[model samples]
Target chain A: MDKVIKGKVWKFGDDIDTDLITPGKWLGSPELKDHVLETEDPDFPKQVQKGDVIVAGKNFGCGSSRETAPEALLQMGIVATFCESYARIYYRNSIGLGLPPLIVPGVSKEIEKGDEIEFSFETFKLKNLRTGKELQAERIPDFLLEILEGGGQEKILKKKLKQKLKELRAKKE
Target chain B: MVRPMTIAEKILARAAGKEEVKPGEYLIAKIDLLMAHIAAARIVARFMGFPAKVRKVFDPEKVVVLEDHFVPAPTVFAANAQKMIREWAFKQNLKYFYDIKAGICHQILPEKGHVRPGMLIVGTDSHTTTYGAYNAAGTGIGDTDGTVAAALGELWFKVPETIRFVLDGKLPKYVMSKDIILKIAGDYKADVACYKSIEFVGKAAEDMSIASRATLSNFSMELGAKFAFTPPDNKIIDFLKGRTEKPVTSDDLVKPDEKAEIEKIYELDVSDLEPQVACPHTVDNVKPVSELKDVEIQQAFIGSCTNGRLEDLKIAAEILKGHKVHKKTRLLIIPASQEIYKAAIKEGIIETLIDSEAIICNPNCGPCFGAHMGMLAPKENCISASNRNFKGRMGSEDAGIYLASPAVVAASAITGVITDPRTL
Candidate 1:
């Protein structure tokens, strides 16, 4: 995982729930990425570029336990998310999918929609490149950080499963 | 000496193999049950992506897979997904697998005796908190987390601080557990209990039936609660009798210590509570049914994991008996599970609903999350007993959804508008 991340911001308002991220109607569709956030902003999927970040108001991911929400954002090339706060399940899903959803108080007011921001996971600081304002984000716990550093839960689980299988094979000899 | 511990703390401590646990402490805990529904397809995909040739679930007996989300296969996409999940379940040789016949996952867990006190349960659906009604620690997780837990039978958690809600006084007529939870949401807002466990206690809570308690815990997710519990009483003990496959021991029951640390205590009197409704776009935008009298609805749905139990159907039937649904509005009644469906039929609740012109659907999630059966059109409004009312939840983004209790939904269906059940 990168210690430092820099990206352009796409701003959203409070209570931007999972439905707005990926609607229920498109649950099992293959082209789900094309409809990502289409309910909130139809142009988001078309206009969003790789390595961009999302900055939003309070309770950014507030509905459903769909990992599809964060998965869609990752597919759209969103590097990370900065919100005032997040619903617990969404925060977990985001971290599990290797998308860092950092809680930075007053992030919506400090950064503009198109502003270029640089964030450091090492220092837990976010700096607005345009205005030169810096904000500190809440530190993620060490256990979750370890998972994030290992490329999310999938990679970590795979490694553990491999070790288990190897041990089982040796035992059978 | 060991410090006092809340019910959530006690459950987590046991799962984590610790003598005691405090809020904000992170630890990996053994899971008693791991559940998945149609989204099991996603979990299976992720689990199969691993390079290990001998991949296997940690415990097949503890894993439950249900086909509830897109039951009966509404579309080709849904059909393929269900097929994938079915094949995977067979391949894994899981012990508890329910096909489309089984109702919603949340309702089936407790109804079938899969849930018990002091257990730590996790599912892929957000309403997994419904299991908390059994005095267990239940919370929802994403597909990847579910996959990991299925493989390892354990997951990490940050022990949540507990919020205590003490409800006293008797509930007035037409008001139910749904109203109490809606009132709490209106008063405290959605994120007030974010990442926290809520313990419901006091006279009113103790008097509620197991079904009513399920409503309280099931809807706790709407308030951002990590877990919600209505302490086990004799009522729960009776409900668990003969229903569980495993024996229930005295060690399974747990309670909060008298001196346990609670983040906050809210005492509410429910003597004068009214039917509450959560308006479109957000669950926290709540109002009494009386205040929404002028809002007309095109459909009134009474079903979901939130309030699709037999108790909810009886309430709806009582109001709909001998009355015809308004010509302008369509009424959709869905029992949460096949067990509830058969019971309702035996109790004549289904006949009463059908006589009132209500379309009784199968035991599945019917149009609750807009997956199938009864989707709303553009500019249409619906009064649903379901949990969520977020934008585009039922169908089109232009359609509106108002969430209320079964009585309120039934009354609204008869009037073709959001009507108070007491008024009817």
Candidate 2:
């Protein structure tokens, strides 16, 4: 299992809604690679690199729960999100897409932009590489953990089911 | 442990056929009503790329497509996007398409009778939960979930525990559902009640009309709730009368037991409430209008799924009747739909607003999106009846936004400042 990812962090203020993240206009487009590279803040897309973490204040996904929001994050290769809180659907959408949204109640105030950070999924902890400070977040369920570990829930389930069928057929033979 | 299930849990359990449901449990549900928006065009494009060898559109009639968010695109980019969506809708053979000329999707759905009480309504839009005001269980979904729901007419759900808000006493003058919801956000912050389905009850919600109840249910999304609802009552029954063709028959009822369990409950008395505004950069940065003294606005918008109802229009028309908007201010009014547009004309409300110099636009989400018609310039400030006020929400990133009730927006249009509608 992938235990930790290290990357520079981009910090944002409260109410970073889905519209600002992926935007509505991009929905109709065939490919999101370039658009995902162009983040909401006019200057962001170029600044964000693959595998960077997004650190934000409260109500991170406050508005519409557009899938584009998570898709953009994933397309940009965002590894994880550390926020004060998340909107209900956005939280679920991220997990469904195999991305992690860590709920660190006060991490928004603690972390800053360009700060290298270490994120751990197994222990549900984030370590600020710059400050040597660490924060813990709420742990996800085992089932969801299995999905995240095996890429995504659908992919994992399909793989396990196939393996189980193969095993039963072999036993019968 | 003997604990009672909340209204939210009861509804989720009934749909899922479980005795009890928790917050994070994932289970499949039999969706009663499924809705889609212009964003569903993405699903269509994907379907074109990789055709789904599955059932298509659970119920085409139950799905609705509203070309809101980016209506009358300010740039060629938005225009191109809208064009793509229109073409996709035609190919899909989905009937409930509301083009940019139609109106905001949320408002058009209930106005068109696709939503009613005691049913599960799912949409691609977050504010789809607003339908719960009529006592239906509705929530928003992502494009993938929407596609699955569209094709299968079924999706999974974890019965969420509910938070009951018992509001007592009559509201003071200048206070309305908008003020009450802002107060709830102020007290609870944005995510304090995250993932909890909210049920607003008591005299406040009870006495309110279906329109007023819609305003309350609409903003529950701002409080980070999965959905918001008020139980079925006479008001809903009365509202259904206008939509006889889409009326709920006896088989559509799911009456909660008198002894149904609730997870958490809170009581509030807002009899002496004041005009409220959600300040810039955050919807939960709520404050009474009087608290932010001497704040002036360059523009005022009175429409969106939130305050675009007939009652909302009439009240604004009443305030603006025979009173001209301020010379320094630009005011815009958008009816919720073509149906509302025609009704306003018949009732003389349209003439009243026009006489007051308010620029009336089509029923789409015009200036609310900061696109097309009324984009605000840098450093400009606006007071709107829309749901959100994040940076760049209405125009430039530097533009400031304040959210208020329709009355307050109309009054601000006249005074060109953050003034109380009652004072006007």
What are the per-residue Cα lDDT tens digits for candidate 2 across B1-424? 4245555665676677777676667777878776666666666654554323332465666666767766667667677767877776676677777777667877777767777766787888788878878778888887666765676666767667677888889988667899899888888787756787888889887888888888888888888878788766777777766774666654464555556556678888888889899989678889998887778899999888889878888989999988999999989998888888899999999999999999998878776655456778888899999888876667677789999999999999998888888877
Model 2 segments beyond 4 Å from truth? A1-3, A19-44, A109-112, A129-134, A146-173, B1-4, B72-80, B98-101, B242-246, B249-261
- Model 1, A27-124: lDDT tens per residue? 77777788888877777888999999999999888889988899999989999999999999999999998999999999999997889999999899
Q: lDDT for every model?
A: 0.91, 0.77
Top TM-score prediction, candidate number: 1
Enumerate residue pairs that collide in model 2. Answer: B5-B261, B6-B262, B103-B363
TM-score of 2: 0.88
Per-residue C-alpha lDDT of model 1 across residues B119-182, encoded as one tens digit per residue: 9999999998888888888999999999999988999999999998999999998899999999
| All candidates: DockQ | 0.80, 0.34
